[model samples]
Target: MKATIERATLLKSLSHVQSVVERRNTIPILSNVLIEASADGAIKLMATDLDLQIVESISAQVEQAGATTISAHTLFDIARKLPEGSQVLLHAAEGKMLIQAGRARFNLSTLPRDDFPVIAEGDLPTSFELPAETLKQIIDKTRFAISTEETRYYLNGIYFHVSDEGQPVLKAAATDGHRLARVTVPRPDGADGMPGIIIPRKCIGELRKLLDEVEGSVAVSLSASKIRFGLGSAILTSKLIDGTFPDYSRVIPTGNDKLLKIDPRSFEEGVDRVATIATEKTRAVKMALDRDKITLSVTSPENGTAAEEVSGAFQGEGFEIGFNARYLLDILGQIDSDLVELHLADAAAPTLIRENDRSPALYVLMPMRV
Candidate 1:
């Protein structure tokens, strides 16, 4: 296979696929990208790590129609370091792939294209399309709460399902026992009968990259075991996690009657300032909500204590709760409104947080002992 592609175009395509290739692999071919050149003036690049696969196509001047596999990272690095606007030529011959750009040249080892594993495109029973911005919003709001612990594998991905409401709505949720984030958006057409699927954490990261700065619509396809996303010129396919997510609805607090309204930015800043004296082990911050003010304080036997008062409106009885400072900050960062509403029942009960904008997104936090 031989083709000539612009440096910028080649780098963009390689950047998208190379990230799917793991740095260490038991199979040599899995470490390389499959490059297929066709006489139709386009080249396809594919990379996979068994669990996730990315395929991208770029326009190129094809001199011959054939296919081969070359080290994905190596080729990406070579293309990235080449002079901007330079034309890159790739030629496969005699068990080696030749790469040339301007005065630079390098020979890379090649694996037979037949050895690369290709994920079969089975019949997808469910398919739909949604605006790219909508998908990005759902992912951004919930991904941070996904569990990194491998033991409870079910919590390692976002749980996606349609709500049981009479009106069609799509919901995405993630939880790690400490905090939970859930977001709901109007369901797109053709997505009514889609089953719940757990999209793995790594897959979400890669999919976000593809949707970054992308407008227009993204096509989604789902099966019982796998999920696929179609971006403009690229495609991502991932295997779904085979576990049941816990009943997240039971954990969300419904009886929290105390309502406290405060400026999110000021509250976040107050927590940050008081948390400076918090112990590194727990990073715990105590919040005391009174009639018209909320006090954020942190006390450590060895580091002393710090406190800051922020003005707020509170109803019902005043209460105090302890929470992880980092976790609280994370939840506050996702709020897009100037005012944040915290619904609380007591010191030990889970607190519900929502922005004033009423975007159908809510966060639940389990209190920590200070």
Candidate 2:
């Protein structure tokens, strides 16, 4: 297809779609992006890794109607390096896709568009829409907790399921053996009866990128085996994990009775400083909570020890607990609020963390015995 698209426009569209294409793929076509001209003055850029697919359209001037595929990463690099606001001319000729902009030209090898595997259409059992910001929030907060273990395939994704509370809720949960992150938001009107789906980790990462530019409501459609996220000019579709998510409700502790309110930034900083001396094997930062001061300490036989005291509001009796510093940093970085609340029962009990004054989100971290 011959289409004249602005460099910035093409780059923006490619930036989203090409990320779905793997840089190194055994199948030649899997690393390429399929470009096709629509009837109107819009061009469609599509990419897939077999498991996840992304399609984005950009306004362009179509001179000849056709379709071709080119290396996704190569095209992205070319577009990115081209001059800003430059007009990009693309055409299929001599079994190669020619990209021209300003004083630069590159001929990228082409593949048959038919070879690319597109996510087939399926009857979505349930459909609903939610604000893109909210959708991003759910994914961003809980995605870090997703298990990376390959043996337990079921735990490798964020589980989207309804909560046991009476009201409609959308919950995203992920757990490695070490820590768990569960976030809940009020469900939209039509999403009350939606079935649980475990969205794959790669799909969630791409979905998060798609949601970045989306400001309006994002349309969501899902079936028992697939889920689709549609933004204004972009769409992400993926196959859902078929296995069942474990009963996470039982793992979250409800008996934690101690409460501590502290500045999220200060708390994270203390953890970072104390963790400097933590052993690589443990990476654990120990917390000593007093009446109104919290001391973070870590000791390593090889690196010595470190201790830092941060002011906080604590009402419960003094207690100490060990936690993986990386996990604490991950959760703290995602929390936007200034103050954070932590509920604790004992040194070994799970710690419940919540953004102070915000009820829409809560985090639970299982403590380590030190």
Candidate 3:
């Protein structure tokens, strides 16, 4: 393949596809990206790591219609280091791929284009278009709660499904047994019959990069076993996790009657200060609530103890609970409002947290025996 592509344009396209290529590979071809130059003055770059694949198309001046495979990271690095506005020429001679930009030239080993594996397209039964900003909100709010433990593989991905509310709404949820996060947004058209799918953690991370600073709508296609997201000139296709996610609806507490309203910043600061004396293993902070005062304390046999008091509006009975300080801070960081509400049942039962009275996002944190 022989083509001339601008340095900036080539770097942007390479940045999108090269991330899918694994650094270490058992199959040599899997470490390479397939580059195809067509007669229509366009170039296509494709990369994959078995379960996930990315294909991007960029305009270039084509001298010959051909295809070749070259190391994805190596090519991306060379393009990034080239002088700005410089034109990069890529050509195939004998069995090596030649890259030339101004005075810099390099020959890279090439793999046969036929050896590149392509993810087979499946019959997607449901399709929808979602605004990129709304999609980003769903991922950002719930991704932090996704489990990293490999043993419970079912909880390692975000659960995407339609809610059972009176009106249809799209919901994204994630939990790691210690904490759960749920966010709901208005459902898009053609998403009524979409089946629930667990999107793998790695796929979610890569998908976030594509949604950054993007506007307009993203085309999404879903099936029972696979899903695809179309982002402008780039496309991402990933295999769905084969495990069933737990019924998260049952985990959210419904009847927590004790209410505490406080400034989120104040509560967060108090927790952070008192948590300093917590043991490294537990990192547990205790909360004691009275009529209009809340005391955050941490006690460790070897590390001593710390206590900080903050003012809040409380109703019902006084109560105390213990929780992981880091988990509390994570949930608090996601809240966008000045005041946050905490609904408590007891010291042992799970506590519900919300940014405000009518916010669509909810967080449930399990209590620890301090």
Candidate 4:
């Protein structure tokens, strides 16, 4: 196999595919990326970790059509250190791969391309295309709340499904039992009758990074067991969690009439300042609310107490509530708009938060007892 590609372009494509390669691999072939230089003047880089896979193709001047497997990390590192604007020449023969850029030349061991596990896309019938920005919004807003607990494997991913609320909408929801985030976007035409799927946490992180570099629309296809995202020259495929997501609609509070409208930035800043004195274990902050202002305070047995005040248009009788400082800051950081509303019933009940009730995105946070 022989191909020549620009250093910058090769580095970008390598960065995308190599991330799917696990550093600690039990199988030697899994540590390598399958480089296939086809006759059509392009080279495809593929990497996988059994559960997830990424394939990226870039335009290259291909003189020969062949395939080879070389160390993913080795190739990425070489591409990263190569001079800017340089052309990278890759040639594989006699069980070795040669990388040449400017005056630097390196030879690396190559594995048989046949040894690389290429997951076959059996049949992904349900497919849809959504604008990149909307997909980015849905993912970024909810992924932070994804659970890390492995015992409840089902809760460790974002649950994606189409919801029919007068109009069909695509909803992405994530929770860690303490906090829940649900975001909705207008459903695409082909998404009707699609199966609900839980995209694992790893896939979410990788896909979110890819979406940052994508524009226009992204094609998505899925079956009951797998989901695939096509972002132009890059494709990501992953296995779906087999467990059913819990009915989350019941957890959202409906009767919390106590309302507070405040600048999310200010509230988030206040939480950061007060949390400085909070206990590391609990990381709890207390909020005392009145008609015009909310006092954010924290108490630590080892460290002294800290407090700050932020003004808001809070309705209903004044009440004090406690919540995890980290959780409060996380939800606030996700708010893109200036104004945020909080609906509260009491200190013991779950609080509902959004830009407003009409907003497509909603959050439910379980209050912590400080």
What TM-score would every model get versus the actual structure? 0.98, 0.95, 0.97, 0.98
Q: For model 4, state the Cα shift of residue 5 in Å.
A: 1.5
Model with the higher lDDT, candidate 1 or 4? 4
- Which residue runs of candidate 1 sit more than 4 Å off their true CA positions? none
Q: Could you tell which candidate, 1 or 2, scores higher by TM-score?
A: 1
lDDT of 3 by residue, 12-72 (tens): 9899899988899999899899999999999999999989999999999999989999999
Model 2 C-alpha lDDT per residue in residues 251-324, reported as the tens digit of each score: 67777779999999999998998887777786988899999999899888888889999999998889899888
**Candidate 1, residues 1-370: lDDT per residue as tens digits?**
9999999999999999999999999899999999999999999999999889999989999999899999999999999999999999999987899999999999989999989998886888999998999999899999999999999999999999987687889999999999999999999888888889899999999999899947899999998789999999999999999999999999898888899999999999999999888777859999888999998999888988899999999998877889999999999999888889998888889999999535778999999987
- What lDDT does each candidate get? 0.92, 0.87, 0.92, 0.93
Judge candidate 3 at residue 209 and give its lDDT. Answer: 97
**After best superposition, candidate 2 residue 38: deviation in angstroms?**
3.0
Q: Which parts of model 3 are misplaced by more than 4 Å?
A: none
Instruction: State, as a TM-score between 0 and 1, how close model 2 is to the true structure.
Output: 0.95
Count backbone clashes in candidate 2: 0
Candidate 3 achieves a global lDDT of: 0.92
List the candidate 4 regions with Cα displacement exceeding 4 Å.
none
